[model samples]
Target: MKNKLPLYLLLFFLIIVNAFFLYNYLGAGDQGGPKDQIRPGDFLVKELGLDATQQAAFRTLGREHHRKMRGLLDDIKELKDALFKGLSDDPSHQVNVDSIVHLIGEKEAAKDLEVFRHFKKVQALCNAKQKEKFAKIIEDGLRVGGRDQGPRGARPEGERGPRSKGFEDNRPPRPNGPNANRPPPAARE
Candidate 1:
């Protein structure tokens, strides 16, 4: 046990250091997702035909927008916590449920409004062509991630559940493509 103490201490220090770096990276930096957001930046350059100086200005505006978005999300989280704390102790009791729900809805709306406001602020910094490109990208994202949709062909697969005929066969084929050496499928007599 004594000999293992140093090893454990070393591991703990490493964890602390890693967590410190992670907090710095994730806390305020890169608020706008990742390289995909960079793709949006690229689209603005290509589709809008922005000059280098304009692109530089847009990057600054994008960073500010990301910072504002982070602030709004933090505010929303605080509001949610306040509402949660205001609730009654009894979970099943309906007391304050309606009020809490309304508060949460308002908080969400505020967050959404902040997002829209930031969008417009950034858009205002861009020329007409840049705004057009941004709108097209936003529209594409809205169409790709529809709420009612799970994934392509989801309904057909859901339709083939255990309740359907041939359900057993639909079980995933063994990793080695039918489990060649496994006992043959039970005689389908």
Candidate 2:
């Protein structure tokens, strides 16, 4: 009976551990639901104080915009793939890199245009006060060195001054240091 006691205790401990793990695994599934999840554009909807109809229209617009953007992105990816694949081709059959790059740029431009049009459509949906708010939002977004202008080394208007050491000016200093007025020896070759 004494030897069997340890076996029974071990079985009980394992059952408890298994039950805990099972409970945790099953419990995690219940934590997520449509109501708990924040969907894209929800913030805009809330900020704009859109009516049900407006919200529906906005969602429809978003879906259409996303579909178009996806198509454009896929096209861009295909172009990029062709561009890279051209690297392996025979010298005589080399792809026109510039044309492919131009096409990629055009696709990117179209994406930007699509986004602009989308926002314009959203602006059209707004009432007077909402439109004002939307305009302010857009204005802030477009402002130079604004919140949207992420860490690309762009400083706010007043922060601009004479070039300082350790500041990133987007151009690296010449290898010969600050006093290097002449071109490198390699360039002379």
Candidate 3:
């Protein structure tokens, strides 16, 4: 009976801890649904304040857009696989690899165009006030890191300050020292 008492106490403690965890975990959303489950079109209904009719249209548009995007994305994945597989074997397959990369780029451009069209449809459904808010949302989404970082993030390759080049090493090369230009260490060893 004493042995059983300890086991019963341990089980009771575990049950209490599990109930506490489940309560907090489920309560985190406050939206009364599973934490991991996402309702795909809920953002339009909730964030954009879409009416029932608009929500239905948005959902339909979203579904069709996603279906088209899925095909493009899958083709991109397949082309990427073929390109990498070429890399693992023949150096002579460079032409084929380049062709695969071009196809992937085309598919990506199509997917991006589809997204732009989808958002344009969404914007059309917005009211004057909602359209203002929607414009802000799109603007914020497009900005790099949510704000223009200016030259710090936007400088072109050769236009970056001289010290920013990969070979700069931030130190003057030793004059005729052991590390001096001896074919850049590639031919030494």
| Predicted candidate 3 versus true structure: per-residue lDDT over 50-98, tens digit per residue | 8888888888888998899889888888888888877777788888877
Q: lDDT for model 2, on a 0 to 1 scale? A: 0.82
Clashes of each: 0, 0, 0
Query: lDDT per prediction?
Result: 0.70, 0.82, 0.78
Per-model TM-score versus the true fold:
0.48, 0.57, 0.59
Candidate 1, superposed: residue stretches over 4 Å from native: 1-47, 82-88, 91-97, 147-189
> What is model 2's C-alpha RMSD?
8.8
Number of the top TM-score candidate = 3
Rank candidates, TM-score, best first: 3, 2, 1
User: Candidate 2 on 75-189: residue-level lDDT in tens?
Assistant: 9999999999898777765448878898999999999999999999999999999999999877876885365756654445435456654465665543452335556666675
Stretches of candidate 2 exceeding 4 Å from the true structure? 1-37, 90-95, 142-189
Q: On residues 43-158, what C-alpha lDDT tens digit does candidate 1 reach at each position? A: 66677677787778778877887787787677767767866776755776455666666766876887788768766765776678778887887777777878546655335433
